[model samples]
Target chain A: MSAQDILVLAEVNQDAVADITFELLGGARELAGATGGQVVAVLLGHDVAKHAESLSAADRLIVIDDEQLADFSPAPYLAVLESLVGSEGPRAVLAGSTTIGLDVAPMLGAKLNAPVVNACQQVAVEGDLLKITAAICGGKVLAEVEVSASPAVLLILPGSFRPTEETGAATVESRPSPVELHRGAVTFEKMILPAPGDVDITQQDVLVAVGRGIQQEDNMKVAEELAAVLGGELAASRPIIDQGWLPTTRQVGKSGMIVKPKCFIALGVSGAPEHVEGMKDSELIIAVNTDPGAPIFDVADYGVVADLLDVAPALTEAIK
Target chain B: MNIAVVVRQVPDLVEPLEIDASGAALDVDEVEFLINETDDHALEQALLLKESGGGSITVVAIDFGQVDDVLYTAAAKGADRIVKIPYDDDDRPPRPAEAAAMIAEAVKDIDAELVLVGSSAHDELEGVLAPLLALKLELPYLGVIRGVKPGEGGSVTAFKEFPGAAMAQMNVKLPAVLGILAADQPPRYVPVSRIRAAMKSTEFEEKETAAAVPEPNVTVLRMHHPEPSGRAEMLTGSEDEVAARLAEILKEKGVVQ
Candidate 1:
């Protein structure tokens, strides 16, 4: 417990550590180098200590094992974090900007009176200042910021850093909950997994994704035709699925599936950062939209500034 | 049950955004403000909860952009009270922590059972308000909630989403903050006539709080548009010409017959 340590909060999924945990560990290692601090990983949950064997990227692993942490409840988690962050004044605390991070980071910042930078993509310590680049406005803009406060709480976006390849062992330290864990106002009931037996968009080589420009449910047929003609599966952005025009399994974005198809055909998609996070790794991307300034064009391999309604039918006919 | 819903306006992304002279913010004069999409969902969820569970909806907002019109629309959609905090600083709103503190001062006396805010806003994707405000109010917090149903014994069954489409049914007790991702139903469309009526009939409750501008924890060194990767080969010309070009490229990639 020292100021010369960088702390990382490891997120758990189905009793195992999530990939974002390792990504944060990797990011923490870089910051640790700049601050000349040891990388410490904080794991909280029941029986989660077994998963700590894979987190060797950190210099030390602190496991707060408790039955109350069997599932994520914000109050207990926040309480435990306040104790830890207060005891060990780390140079910075890093967490993934996912559900858990977004839920707890701000509260933790308020509790500790520390600065918190969200959607953080890059962190650099220049001279005596800690600088960060955060993606705001749905990835439409990037802002470079400097944090003048000590022990900054940084919520890092997933996929921003590569997972560490180092495989050394970490010093494991087991500790009990600092505060008495009580059943608070929040209780975790059960997990709801997406239904199976749908066309898995993640496995498909070619995907035709539609967005809000599809407009109505009836217009989905045009995108489906384009998908069929391309020998591909039909996927959609969040808006289409939110309208219940497609199953949740067919949705792509930060909250939905992360896909890497060989050929991605985006129709009328404005390409918000969340949606772009899913398909940016596709081998080739073709975007069709009426707006020439749509962010989709920035990531597309081929961009067509035209109405997708017209382009869809014409592409279906042209392919046939 | 008494519910407090927070709504704010963000820059409409339909048009391109320009950088300001300061190089650290957007050119707000050239931007148009629209009610954040998720905040609209938050308002809708509040309205739905009120409709089903029997409650009063109080819509609160920071005075920025054309928020008066948004408050009127909420009134037309069944909000019982409207509270507007007077703020006329730069176009950029307060940071989440300061904003949360400011809002906490306004709503702390309401003694509401639930505080619903959008999970994230287009202008500020961090979605920190709910949790920060929860910390201030000493309440539990949940974010990325898709649907919320009033549960037995002063709790609500919140359908909260994890990453990768996984969801969980959480029993969040009353006096909690929920960052709503979407409502069970789409936001209702109030007729223009109804809005005009609301404008004429509705009175706003003003809350005066000390707007001490704290030094920003995070100082923006620069703000700029994301640089295009330049990998995109824009297919220009008429729609037919682009479609033909796309087909040939798809064929070359061996992705189509």
Candidate 2:
């Protein structure tokens, strides 16, 4: 009930607590140290109490179980969060910069008349205010922002914070729904999964990834040849997947698979933040693009400022 | 059904961006502006819906960053009406909250059954506008929708994307807001002659509304391009030389052995 507390909105997927929720808990723990308040994790779902046992980084866990929250609909989630935030006033609320978090933050900001910051890569508490560095313009630029208002809603990008190693016994409280629930205008019908039986890029040891600069479908043969020479698989950025040159399963990005292969070779990939977040943790990274200023070079261990179209075939021939 | 689509003009990212003197934003004068990619998809979705279900699309935009060209192009692609909210401030682009407030003010009287906007933009990667606009109008919102089709009895079926490439088919009632990630088909390529014809015949309906900018909650302290971390060892040479070096490196790492 302390105003200095930092509140974390727990996100659940497939009836289990999501990894991003743990990331949020880790971030909240750090912010709570400065605010001098306990870290409070609010879990909202149907039959979610069992998931709270893993949120050890939080000092307190609050679970709200209700039938209205069985599936994530915007209206009911907003209603519950609004009432909870109003009653349990905290210095700031942290959520993932994810599909669900992006959908929820703005609505909650409007409902509470609070300021919302998104795409936060780093956050710190300065005296009574908060300082955040947000990655915007698709990771080409970074903006440092100051939150001068209390009760701010901050949406953190995934992979910005590591999960906390501290294992503490958090006191749990099961609370009832604070507001009446009704069927909203939006109804979730069913979940659709990606098609199976494709090469799982996440399980690969060596990956050759292409991007829009690969020219067209014809150029894909070059990358495939290189991957074959290396005995590896082929992956692509979002544009390649969107253009249907590669299937969604071969896409490596925020919306696709997060891969950490032993050897990652990126061709013609400009390395937008969304794409970089998926493969930045590879054991060894190599990138080749025509543009010298491509952001992919920032994370790549080796960079070649040349056309991947020329390098791919030549490298494949050399390897063969 | 009457649908309203919000089209925005953003800096073309193909060109390298130069940081402004203030170190807090882009140097707008040097960059070229184009219709945002997803917003173009939103316009295309609106057109597809009109063709299939017999509806009218009223394209709306704030008068910023060559938005007139986008409106004209929408008209060329079969938009029924063009609505422009008067915004002359060019020193900086409107924040998400302010833009959503202004858009809500402009579109409230149109009585549109559905409002479609791009799910995210390059400048504001957070994609907060659609939900903020929905809250301001007291309408239910669904963001990150890939494809949408008209459903039975004033409802639309939307395929909303989740993390890990999962999707959910959602049934949304009329008078809702959708943040479109992509439309069913790619945006049609309207020829130059069609745009010229639209320019001659299309009349923009100017809607003047007092800008109600909410109090600033977040203020930019600084902005800059990411400094190279020196992690990448630049291999500078001709194509053959670089390819030879890459082959050697791969062999050393046992990747191409």
Candidate 3:
């Protein structure tokens, strides 16, 4: 039963365990309950131990406080995790589907000769089996997959599982660095900040965000009229920003600005998790897309199945 | 130095996508296939590295719909060598793990010093391919990189994206993998005339790796629309009617008077 325990690598962003870490910890609790195993959190950072008290989802927390491991260089993190896996032999290793998770999960899986079930939106146990639900073809095709039985590594997408409010009285254990301090091959350089854009879309109460389905830059005028009529700010998904159709500040999603607008209307946005993460919390969401299977519709409070080309200007005229 | 870039072919999901009969996968027979918005960044990154540092660039992929066109396009963009694994188009398309194993087996013979791939492919949800491929190759991989440059002593410095417009720079040792979110710049545009010229002259090296294609550890049991079912109240009718319907809802929500 100890072999089946789950080890979670808590991710730290800006000196704190990220929201995704809390989300994954919540998922880990459910998984541990299914396997009758304990959940352990690996806390590695300059002052990461402070998070130990807040990580109530874990049955135990292993704190490896070291300044040398402060920055995210894959080699050192891998070294620590490999050593932990060696000693703990947990059957399942869970990581947040962040940059760190994408960087580390596969490498660790390769090192352990184990298979990885990546980007699981949902996890369920059918009898003794673990099924990871993932999406492909831009979230149109949903796949329910089973990882290797004995042990599996999973990268769970953010916003898929709700963070639980459960609490635990887990004791913390401090361990010395198992690997030498001579710094791994990868060395951290300075952090480069994004340029400040013209307008901050986060401050707006209502947002009208567009994606590739808008088809061309010229059509942006139609979306503009809608935004203007509704007195909402204009925002876009990444492609629009990448194509220079809009300023970076007006972009919404993981790599862009996160907006919790009171009312968000998504036009032609297919709702990739990255984009969804930014606007999913809008008090009211209305998504218009031609593709019924588009992932954006999954999260929308009100969904419209129609071509944006037909609907955009029409909605603007009606609103006027 | 030898460098390899993993090129992938995927359906332009932005266009209409249809599900297959068994509901197993996308209906490839009906949809148009193209290399959508990935890997070419890796190609550009490889070219940039080759230009500044000395290296031969190789493009690698498994046979998917229109992969030859993608490899040929890579050739047009300045890949020195192109290799593709010939596998069944009917068998379930290779998942990230299986693709990595197949690519690793084929790449073993090429002996690349560094491998660069797009940060994430649209088809490879949550960006799994590069890290998975790097693992099978047993190489250290850096993901979500915006920029990369050759460093002293066979190491490279890569800039990875952080939220709130922050970028982290790291000096990673060579024989490594880099997931290119953006190259030094967007992929250099190879003109249509040059690509057609490349198509005629290029020699694609295709290897039969059906046996090397490992069975997918993860099997897709079923596919269906997402639920919290019937949540959206569809507003249908003529344009005027639909607009009136939407406006009424907005008024109810207090977004407008």
Best by lDDT: 2
Question: Per-residue lDDT of A124-203 in model 2, one digit per residue for the tens?
Answer: 99998899988877677888988867788998888778877777899999988999988899998999888788888999
- The interface RMSD values of the models, given in order, are 1.8, 1.8, 3.0
DockQ of 3: 0.53
Please write out the lDDT profile of model 1 over residues B22-127, one tens digit for every residue: 9988888888888877788889998898889898999988888888989999999999999999886866766776777788888887778999988877666333
Q: Write the per-residue lDDT of candidate 3 for residues A245-264, one digit (tens) a residue.
A: 88657879866678898899
Residue B89 in model 3: lDDT: 55
Tens-place lDDT digits, model 3, residues B119-229: 677666422788778767877778988778888888888988776556798888988888887777667778888889889999989876644544455556666545535
TM-score of chain B of 2: 0.94
Ranking by lDDT: 2, 1, 3
Candidate 3: TM-score? 0.90
DockQ of 1: 0.70
Worst 10-residue lDDT window for candidate 1 chain A reads A238-247
- In candidate 1, the residue pairs with backbone N, CA or C atoms under 3 Å apart (3 or more residues apart, or in different chains) clash, namely none
Record all residue pairs in model 2 with backbone atoms less than 3 Å apart, i.e. clashing.
none
Per-residue lDDT, model 1, residue A189, is 94
Worst 10 residues of 1 chain B by lDDT: B121-130
Question: After TM-score superposition, what is the CA distance of residue A86 in candidate 2 from its true location, in Å?
Answer: 1.3
Instruction: Mark the regions of model 2 whose C-alpha exceeds 4 Å error after superposition.
Output: A215-219, B125-127
Q: What is the TM-score of chain A, computed separately for every candidate?
A: 0.94, 0.95, 0.92
